[model samples]
Target: MIDLTSIYHRAADNYCYLFDEETLHIRIRTKRDNVLEIVLLYGDQYEIVDHQWITSLQPLEKIGSDSLFDYWQVAIKAEHKRIRYGFILKNTEQEMTLTEKGFFSFIPEDSGFFFCFPYMHKSDVFSSPDWVQQTIWYQIFPERFRNGDPLLNPAHTVEWGQEEPSLTNFFGGDFQGIIDSLDYLQDLGINGIYLTPIFLANSNHKYDTIDYFTIDPQFGNINLLKKLVEECHNRGIRVMLDAVFNHCSVEFLPFQDVLDKGEKSLYKDWFHIHKFPLKDGDTINYETFGFYEYMPKLNTANEEVKQYLLKAAAYWIAECQIDGWRLDVANEIDHQFWRDFRTTVKAIKPDLFILGEVWHDSVSWLRGDQFDSVMNYPFLHKSLQFFSYDIISAHQFTEDLTTILHSYSDNINQVLFNILGSHDTPRVLNECRFRKERVRLLFTFLFTFPGTPCIYYGDEIGLDGGNDPGCRKCMPWQEEQQDLELKDYIKTLISIRKETSLLTSKGTLYFLPAVNNCLAYYKQKDNQVVFVLINNSDTEIDYVLPFSLSGKKINLLLTQQEYAAESDELSVTLAPYESNILSFYI
Candidate 1:
């Protein structure tokens, strides 16, 4: 008997989203091992022939399965640019039709009972810059990356990389520093750079923006920034600046006017002030970023505020020719503001990448109108829990990973801001408990997994630090102080990924049955297949491929060695914490 409770589908959101202006993708979930197949019956609700609705039939392919459910998806298009769809699912015993209303013994003739996709408007299509999917990103914290020009350093500036980092101190990292290291970044195969907030601010971290129109004096002036961007563009590198529009430093002139004049201030409505006289004892008069008093949240709904911020957004892109913007606290601001933000920025440069700094499930923000993609924290959580803390088994890790993949559509997944660590979080090495083997294993997955991957400034050199203040350590410049071996290893991985298109968004991903503390997966693009296997256990284990590899030519990607499979079943051995990538033709 088919389990009715196991079936699930939705007409909108990730379950159904536009792949392009003309193509639409629909997905469904069923209980694991309970359903044998799913066939889709779809048609335009209005068109009819011979007193019957015109219809089309197609089979849904099984894309992935978790511990409890299997995911199936199909892409389709309606001649009328709209569709009403239903499913016919089969089991060992019987088959039944599933519509939006309920299950039936036969396919519903009335379109009212089916799921409806109103229209596929060209404007509704979820589109983003295509170049982002192919680029590898590196993130740099300006205050700590390097000190290229000591002339502008604060009088209290300290020696580079000699002491611990603090919230208040400065080290004079600037645009010249990044410009000076463009060759090094190019040498490491990085084509995109994400710089934290660099606007004029009072704090060393620069998250509290005092002015949106000017670059921080300590970092560099407009000329130096334009020069840095020009140099990066010459090297095929893209630049992304952080937008702190969610809040501004308490020192902002408008907020200061509000503070001094209270109810009588002309800019009193610019902020979310609750009561006059600013604050009453412990009660704050206005909202702020978290509980901190220095960072006051802006009323994004205000017309003047929205236009002012949008102008700033377009100015930097036009002036510096920057390629992207990472919006901070994007979810907290009004959705309408972001919709306007997208329209404003895209007008100047249609291909500008707009990324949101959301940390949770961000499906609502990725509907093509608001954001292209958000920071993928779920990936970081699952990876660290499995590899760093050993809180989950390899089997559980694969299930969770598949769940993450199913959480969004393929288009959004391709350009996700996938990072293991950023300036706000603990360094990847610290998360792995200072174990180099585990760190190496984690990074292997980072670069190999789907989506555009990012490396923190000092991560490739084995930088270790704890959370915030600690995670923001200065970048080391001395050759002897860096980990050359690890750097070379990361560089090679980037090179291999760039060389093989299948490893990027060009290939399709599927998780294999994990066995004996070994996790396995593969990507296939046409006849080319690249298989990845990793052993999490201490002792060596033999893993057998689920599908036969009979008479196939396999070339190991880590080391370009060729081998032939002698039998139908190919069993390979993996050493402790070892990972290998194999490429072959089907």
Candidate 2:
């Protein structure tokens, strides 16, 4: 019997949204494999025939299926830019019509029974910067990328890559260091650089920001920061600075004033204080960033605090000409504050990328009024679980990924900030137990996957470390210490991704069935169809592709080798941990 409750559809939000100004994507979900077919009953709500509404029928194609549901999508164009739609679903045992009002046994000609899209409002579309989809980002922790100017080394700064990374250690990596390393990043084929906090602060990491206006003296002055952005821009690299608005250091002037004057201070509302007269005891009296005594959470709801932070957000873009912002602890802040922040920043530069640091589901923040995208930690966890830890099978991993893909509109998914590792997590190499081959497969999948991909500063060189302070290791500048082969492999992937529109947001990239513990997916754009097959298991596997490549020209992207498909079904033999990207045209 059909699961009547499982059939789902809405004419707005993630289920239905604008792909572009002219195209609207409407989606419906049903019990997995239950519905034999979905017929879209759609027409402009105002269009009528003899005092009754007239509609057209279009069959919806199944775009994806996860464990519990089948997802179907159809892009529609309404002649009057308005639509009334409903689904006619047929199962093996029964057929039903679903509308906004209720289920029906027969088609409803009245517009009142259908889901309504009043108008195609341009503002409703979730639009990010166009260039963000193609961007390959590199995240740099300013204290450890390189030591270009030894003159600016902080007191007690250790020699580069000397001691193991620690919470308190500083290796004197400054903006000039990054400026000097532009050629290296350029060679790696990265177009965007996400630099962690460089603001004046007492700690080595600078996450506890003391002054948002000034660049840390240890890093560089404002002029040098400008020069770094200028230098990066010259090399066709975009620069995005970290903005830590959720909390700030105790040493920040406003916080200091509140500390000294308590209830009498004019800036007492700058931070969340419980019953004044702050204490240093274990039981602190104020809200902070996850119980950290030094980082007091800001009172974003306070009017003065809101304007103060919003001004600082505008300052960098207006002054340094930066390309984006990566908000720290973004989920903790009030939504209206971010809404205002978006309006303020985008007014200055419409193309600026605004990415939020959200570890969990973030559909609430990805609307056009807020962030352009979020740090896709779900993608990180799943990738590490499959490739690094070998805990999940390829079949299970693909099911998990498909669920996430259907949760957001394609526009939001394409601009997502997909990260493998970061300052807060273990290095990808460390997660893979230093297996170079596992890292290779992981990198291959990341570059081939949709959304904007980011590389942690030293990930290219096979840097290995555990979480937090350990993950913040110094970048090895010496050629002998670097993993040259891994770097080249990642570089090649970036180059191929830039050249192939199939890998970008232009086309579809979905998983094929998992076979013999191997993962496979294809990217199809027009006559060009591309497949990426990876042998996840340790043992060599003779994998069979789901689609036939008979009588077509096939080209392996990584190796540029050409082949002619002799049979309809293609059988590919892959060694342990080996992956290949094969492409063919009709």
Candidate 3:
């Protein structure tokens, strides 16, 4: 058997409370070279008898592996919220039982030998807002969305949709524009709007924040924001504003003070400065987000900075009654500040959502104390690889998705900010090489899959662009320029999503086997099931439903067609780039 002496630690990230007070999530790590399967034996601590242990066995899944170790995980629901658990690990050579005491050849007779979770408290459970599951989010890059109030427009603003966007250009999209578009958004059936940074900043994107307390004049003031929030709430839409706390613009007051006063500045500790004289040359004297010298990284570890940002967070929620915050470059900041931020914001509004922008695995910030969820960039990457690039097969896509699903607990997976396109990336339509049919298939998969789905602005109407300045195009207001069919299709999908509970975050997802280049999955919640099928290839294919689904009445949600399965293997033909969302009673 492999040596188990080096493995240890059952702390926060390794073991966590998931879903509710009764559920516990645990992870174990072993040397990377070992090929071992682990089974957990767990039961109530009080259930042990004399020299006999009454326990249940659960096999752990190997969720992830890196260069140094393999990580195994499992989630167990203890009825009493107290658990005594031990691992039974086996390799090709021998098997051993591991507990708090040590590894042994047989199970320990005493309950004290097992590892114990004292109690899973309700307050410690990781949960997002209840309203999140029901939300279909729309991401808006304000500078390009619309120019409702031209008086608030920037001096050099160009004609809407006439000129291509540049790094310095602004098209005058503001809060009033969003207020004016509330009817359009309501008609589109989305209940959540995620607006990129609206705080005072130097650039058009507002990512390099100048002042957190004030809204940019180009985007309107606090009054406009309040009115926009009220209007959105009136239309049954929740608003989430972007928080750019990781860095600040060079022109920011504090940063300007630091530049003027150097080491003598009282605000010197707010930023990370490397030298006595702050220089603006290509070789940066201070630490920055990237190579850009203007966007200096904030010292989130500083106590004063922490309180300042936390207060700003509390101000937005308490004053405007916003529903959530989408943290920008969240991974670079220290986790402690985020914990404080969460406490500060949730104290004002307990259910306010906190979403972090993390591109990779965010297990560290996703505990009960910090962020509620993170941007699902991995989902976008895998989906694009399969649908846009056509590099990976359907089976590989399913396997990749399964790995992502297993990486986090079901609770975190449910509220993940799943997005196909955003301001930073190329438009989804452009990624698909302008293939409307491919875009339709991707949309079908996005809506039917588990998690809260988000659409970037202008995506529903088939806006096409490349990266950065290209993706940030002016939203076309003219109906003749819009793809009404695509918009209507997206609206239909949203309507179906809102009406179907199984398509929401509460549903349990399962991947069904299908032919090459064809992907299929089923989501089930209680008695209702939603089966989704997508054909990514250029040729037609026949898909056979599992034997368990035979003799059931299936209702196609989009086409409004009904069919009755006749045999154990129900066959359906899908043309190239065609997709389907079928609902049935089980």
- Give the C-alpha lDDT of model 1: 0.89
Candidate 1 per-residue lDDT over residues 1-586, each given as its tens digit:
9888988999988789888888899999999989999999999998898899988899999998888899999999778899999999998898999999999988879988999899998887777798887789999999899899999797789888777888888888888899999989999999999999999999988899999999999998999999989999999999999999999999999999888887898888778887777778887878999989899899999998999899999999999999999999999999999999999999999999999999999998998888988989899999999999999998899999988898988888877888889988999999988888888888788888988899999999988889899999999888787888889888878987898888776334898877877889998877878888888879897888765678999888876688888888888788998888888887
Q: Tens digit of lDDT per residue, candidate 3, span 335-454? A: 888988988898999989999999999988987889999999999999999999989888778778876875677778888999999999999999999999989888988888778999
What local lDDT does model 2 show for residue 290?
A: 96
List per-candidate RMSD values in Å.
Answer: 1.5, 1.2, 3.5
Return the candidate ranking by TM-score, descending: 2, 1, 3
Q: Extract clashing residue pairs from model 3.
A: none
* Clashing residue pairs found in predicted model 1: none
In order of appearance, the predictions have TM-scores of 0.97, 0.98, 0.91
Better candidate number, 1 or 2, judged by TM-score: 2
Top-scoring candidate (TM-score): 2
Give the higher-TM-score candidate: 2 or 3: 2
Residue pairs clashing, model 2: none
RMSD of 2: 1.2
- TM-score of structure candidate 1: 0.97
